[model samples]
Target: MKPRTLVIGDIHGGLKALKQVLARAEVTAQDTLIFLGDYVDGWGESAQVIQFLIELEQKQTCIFIKGNHDLWCEDWLKEHILDKTWLFHGGQSTLKSYESLNDAEHALHLNFFERMRLYYVDEQNRLFVHAGFTSMHGPAQEFHQSNFKWDRTLWEMALTMHKHITKDSKLYPKRLLLFKEIFIGHTPTLNYDVTIPMNGCNVWNVDTGAAFTGSLTIMDIDTKEFWQSDTLVSLYPNEKGRNR
Candidate 1:
């Protein structure tokens, strides 16, 4: 049997939830795991989460995409400057997680973050992006850095586009037809009023809002089968989440 390509949504430092989602998904050595980023911030345990991922890489294939939060983290690690925006959006918890690490350990974590990708395209033309592509030229065109980690217009377009239009209703946008499937995570599924993964046009949103009150999601790229953890609030019963 072929190993499944499992694409996971934003983790947001929810280590317990991340563990449960992986366990429920029955992840194994043969499976390929693609993390959608925002690995730090929100809940506590950001350091431990990165450590766990580093260890997991020794056993299975894993791909880490860079999200907006992850980019902030990289900036902090590389420049040694605190970003006010990152701080306002759960950066404190991430900083707390790294406070105890020694120089070597800190370097290891930084290296991992530095190696993350902006976007990944598979052989079949499927695109996996942290947020979404922003090229007016479409998916085949290289995207700007902001588009890969911070673009919300793609999701907005996907959500609001008309399913059917008159023949003369202006040229249908080419963005929706650029890829066989585009998987993303920055936009939480709950925003769409659904807790589970929601498919719009050819885009699939897997971020079930692990940073807030939502659950963590893990889905099979081909099968579309998914498993999710309990509500994030339940994962850290004793503490309030970052944005909660």
Candidate 2:
């Protein structure tokens, strides 16, 4: 089989959904998996999800990008401090997931989180980030690093300018011109009533809201072919996930 580059959406601790999508996509060791992060803080298996990824990289090439939720979880793992907002937004579930982990295991997961990249620029000039960056100079020159994990302005601009303005137009966003293509996942496509990956201009959003009622997604970046898992709400019926 040919080596392929696959971009995955947010897992949000839905290990079952993550597994399903990988299987559906027929992922292999020959493929390079680029995960968009948020691997924890939604469902009941936050620790398990991180554990699985740690083990996965041993056999395959994987690029992990850190998300806003993952940052919060890393803080708790390193300092054992809980943020009230994080707790309300699925941090409690993440805490419960780590109860069974020993100190050694916690240390390993913390190391994994710390190693994640905020953004990655491929040789082909494709940018993969958990969310979006604010700098017109591109992510490398971004003044606010948090924007890499939390900005929505880039995606919003893409949507607003998509089809309305051409690349040659003076009104075209300079940030959008920075890359051949941009792939992101912090903002769920389900928010716009879509359950599949969304494309606006050169930006592709793969987050299908697995943290709530949608499915997890994995896309072949070159082909734009994708696969999805069943709705996360149905997969773990008893848990509210991030729906609460």
Misplaced by over 4 Å in model 2 are: none
Best by lDDT: 2
Worst 10 residues of 2 by lDDT: 235-244
Candidate 2 lDDT over residue span 126-193, tens digit each: 99999999887889899999999999999999999989999999999999999999999989998899
lDDT of each: 0.87, 0.94
Candidate 1: global Cα-lDDT?
A: 0.87
Error of 2 at 27 (Å): 0.6
The number of clashing residue pairs in model 1 is: 0
Alpha-carbon TM-score of each model against the true structure: 0.94, 0.99
Question: Per-residue lDDT for 12 in model 2?
Answer: 90
How would you encode candidate 1's per-residue C-alpha lDDT over 1-244 as one tens digit per residue? 5799999999998999999999999889999999988999989888889999999999999999989998888888888879998999999999998999998998898999999998888888888998987776765475467888888888888777646542234665577667788899999887767899988777889999888889999999999999999998998987666664
